[model samples]
Target: MKTTERVEQAFKRIKELLTLVTDWTKQPKEEDALTKEFREKKLQLIEDLYKQLGELNDRFMFTHESEFKTKEYVVQYDALKKKIHDLEK
Candidate 1:
């Protein structure tokens, strides 16, 4: 698959995971007891996302330098980073 396609897929997955995070946060009080397991799973998902993000960054930096494409991936990477940070907290 093309780099652009790969990046787009990563973005979609990140957005989905973010939605999961939001839903997890909105769970009722009774689910509070499962928060630890829920968080661990989310954190693991973020780690996997980071792997893809890192590959995209490396491709942009080392293979080809296209401002338009790099900007696109960078924006998604930044957004995913922010989500991961929020979940970490």
Candidate 2:
């Protein structure tokens, strides 16, 4: 290939790479904490809260409808679990 053609091909590759990365970061999605430690801590806290709430129910035999509703928010932590990400930056 001519020198001009080689340079043009290189520029094309660079442009493609820039486009790929640019589009990827354009939109941000709601995600749990980026760090493993934080996610683990949050997960742990959720488990602890669940266990304590269970113990409280066992001791007091909860009957109120609102008391049952309190556990609904704990489901939010299911998606907040520490996912073992395989992708490298």
Writing each residue's lDDT as its tens digit, candidate 1 over 1-89 gives: 99999999999999999999999889575656478788779889889778877876777777655554867877888987887778677
TM-score attained by model 1: 0.46
lDDT of all predictions: 0.80, 0.60
TM-score of predicted model 2? 0.36
What does candidate 2's lDDT look like per residue over 1-89, in tens digits?
99999999999999999999998888655555566677677667767666665665554455566655545535533333322111110
TM-score of each: 0.46, 0.36
Top-TM-score candidate index: 1
Q: Candidate 2 at residue 89, lDDT? A: 8
Looking at candidate 1, the ten consecutive residues that score lowest on lDDT are 59-68
lDDT of 1: 0.80
